[model samples]
Target chain A: MFLFFLSSGMFLGWSLGANDASNVFGTAVGSRMLRFRTAAILCCVFVILGSVISGAGATHTLGKLGAVNAVAGAFVVAFSAAMSVYLMTLARYPVSTSQAIVGAIIGWNLFSGSPTDSNALSKIIITWIVCPILSGIIAVISYKVVSVFILKRKIHMFRLDEMTRYGLVLMGAFGAFALGANNIANVVGVFLPVSPFGYIELFGDFCVSPAQQLFFLGSLAISVGVITYSKRVMDTVGSGIFKLSPVMALVAVWAHSVVLFLFASQRLEQLLLDLGLPTLPLVPVSSSQAIVGAVVGMGLLKGRHNIRWRTVGGIAGSWVTTPIFACLISFICLFILQNVFQQTVYLP
Target chain B: MAFISIFKNRTGIESEIDSFLNLASESGLIFMQGIDAYLLNNLDSFSEHLSHIVETEKEADTLRRSIEDLLYRKTLIPESRGDVLELIERMDALLGRFKGVMFRIEIERPNINSQFHTGLKSLSNCVIEAVESATLSLRSYFKDISQASDHIHKVAFWETEADKASTSLQKAIFNNNELGLDLKMQLRDLVRSIDKIADHAEDLADTLAIYVIKRSL
Candidate 1:
């Protein structure tokens, strides 16, 4: 029964992997700088490592937004979010798994008569708005610096091509790890409170917590999605949306990885606090949004006419609609799971 | 280990491209020597220069094929591969034209009057300079795109000089009443043939300018 309930979260994980892995490796693969197999293998290994090592920070934030204490309720929340994402994808609008999962958790809080922590809700919302803007700024600066360096160096064209290939591979690895660390919460955060797994003792004093184990499972599902289903999406995003040269592609991936790392790295947060500086809130921000922001930043740097405003407007519209759809689906589904199936959805 | 191999291959390919361009320039020099020897009635030197150019063209063709193979096999420069390949092939065709004109002179062995020798030599010199400028522009395109425009404009300059030399030589041939119409026409054809090499070089220079612009970061 626990496995049955965890399947929904795994499905959500799979969906996230299928869609978001493209943000990291799409341009590399699409531009033929890196093969799809090479990218998928690196992405899978690094994503799992990231989820198990640093996934707790974002999950903690999601837990604050709403703690669904029942395993069945967690299943319903994940399922609703996945359904909304699927529907949105079918409608051909850009969707963010982070947004859908957040809205679904709030729906569970409302259904269970648990007050959603307004502070956590506000922080998460604000982070969503700030994530893309920060990514764009980083991308613009990085692109300018790299362009100037290449020009000043007067590197041979073939040498530059080889260097860009290696850069894409390295940045793709970082982007995959950051994606796992940041977005794993959207896959299994709701299940943390009602986890059925036990902690594992490693070496003499080392231990793997239950949350880590749950995250490992979710990340494995994501890895499977990457290996099996991400190639087509990577190809599409790499070539269709924005025609990026390999250098621009590297900049976009670098900016996306750095933004995800900033939002998800607990060590960075602690270091900022120790330095008496304000820390960014740890949250699951959309990889797709970060990539899009980076691409747009590069386009803007080149010229305003380079951007397709209609595509940007359509993506922004989906951001508003995805969460609302997930919320409604979660509320109705939770009602059926509770009364119709005769299950207790909340301790209260 | 893989990265080291890429580095080694990159250096090898870079030098190979340099050698190929050098061969193109070398062939132009040999073509000018062959034309000068023919006008001076030095059959032995003319034949020697012709064989040297023929060998140079063969060497360039072989080098070009190897470079194209390496580029495609290794998948380097995915974005600019087509442009680079086109540039190399067009330059090779230009070298072939040099060889073709040399062969024409070898076969026709036109009896050139001493009075026309200076005009023919001057025209050949101008055409070779235009080709040399085109080669320099191509080299700059690979090493420093900023310097490419500097060499590209010079190709046009040399091409105009060649046009002036060819026009004056044709006028000299047509004005000489001692020469038959057939001989005048033959000499005019030779002059135009040499002039056309410069025209081809100018066209390549224009294409390279566009490629340099495309290559800018």
Candidate 2:
């Protein structure tokens, strides 16, 4: 019964990998600089490593947003988020796992008659709008710095190409790692409330906790999605950020990584707080938003001609609607699962 | 659908640019043949080769336009798209010069003294060599960029030889009593025109060199 409830979490994880992972390496693969197979392999390795190592921090913030203690409640929440992602994908919108997970949490709260923490909810919402804007600002600065340093250096064309290729691979690895660290909360956050497996000693000294087991399984599902479905998404990603020079693409990815790491890294947050500096909120920010922001920043810096405003309008519209759609869907699904299906959704 | 098409999966745009280079090279071959027949006073063969050169130029033009369209329409390799476009346009201009020189030679049909035949033929060979070298350098830019400079230097060398050959031919035309003063000037213009073909080729080769450097560093 416990294993059965994990299905929805895995499904959500797969969807996150399928969509978000595409944005992670889309420019490199779509440009034919890096092959799809190579990008996918790198994504899988770094994303999994990121999930297992740095995944714990963001889950606490998600838990504070809403704790659906019942396994059945968690299942419905994951399912609702997955449905939202799928719907967004079909419409060709930039799907955000952070939006989906947060929406699902709100739905769980409303359905279980638990009070939603207004302060936590506000922080998440603010980050959603700020994340992309921050990404754009960082991208503009990075592009300017790199353009002055590398592009204007008058280096030989062949040498510039080799260097850009290497830079893309390095930024790609870092982006994948940042993505796994920040966004794994969208996969295994709900499952933390009612993890099925306790500590199991595989070797004499090696043991794993219930949360680790769930996260590892969730990470595997994300990997499967990257291996199977992310290719199509990656191709589309190339066209979204047009007129990007090699250095510009690298700057965009680097900006995105910085935004994600700032939000997701608990050690950084702790260091800030200890140094008498304000700590950034350890929230699971949207990778899609960050990357889009970076692209927009670069585009805007170049000129208005660089961006297709019609496309930008459409993507922005989708971002506004996704959370609302996901919240309503999850609420409706939880009500039906608890009342109509006679399943326990919330626990005392 | 348009958006999806823009993101359509494809391999290196360098290969597409290569196909255009190949077409340009074919027309270069046609240009060389037309001049060879022109020098031999074989009107029939010259006409045949000239017509073929014209046809190849038209085809090359069409290919170049199509490549430009594809580059603008698709978002593949946004980084290098501009460089590739510039390269093709330069090569396309060289093809036009090829056709122009051939057309001028056919219309004028200057009666050359056999004594100057060796100089003219040697000059024509040098021009062809420059064009060939330019095409080779561009090819190597795609396949093996490290080898690109070696081919580019050859283009420069042949261009220099062509300059010397044309200038020597001009001096000889003036010294000979067999040709009238007015005829000598006309023949001199023809020699200069032939040298321009090589000049155009060298210009393209120089552009390719800059592009190679831009991509590498």
Give the winner by TM-score: 1
Each model's DockQ score: 0.73, 0.11
Q: Please give the range of 10 consecutive residues that has the lowest summed lDDT in model 1 chain A.
A: A86-95
Q: Taking the tens digit of each residue's C-alpha lDDT, what string does model 1 give over A1-348?
A: 778888898988887777778889987887787879989999999999999998887543346687777778878888988887767555444467878888888889889889988887888789778988899899999998998998889988888888998899778888888778877887887677778789799887899999999999999999997898777667656765566788988888889889888987889999999999999998767777788788778778878776767766766787788889888899999999889999877778
Steric collisions counted per model:
0, 12
Tens digits of per-residue lDDT, candidate 2, B1-217, equal 5223323323334445667778777877787777777778888998998888788778878878777776666544456768777877888888888788778877887888888888988888898889888888977776666677898999899999999999999999998987899889888988898899889888888888887776552
| Local distance difference test scores for all models | 0.85, 0.78
User: Highest DockQ, which number?
Assistant: 1
Docking class of 2: incorrect
Q: Clash pairs of candidate 1?
A: none
Give the CAPRI rating of model 1: medium
Please write out the lDDT profile of model 2 over residues A151-182, one tens digit for every residue.
34544343455566667888888788767766
TM-score of chain B of each: 0.97, 0.90
Candidate 1 runs further than 4 Å off: A53-61, A87-94, A189-214, A264-282
lDDT of 1 by residue, B140-213 (tens): 88888889999999999999999999999999999999999999999899889989999999999999999888
User: What lDDT is reached at residue A150 by model 1?
Assistant: 86
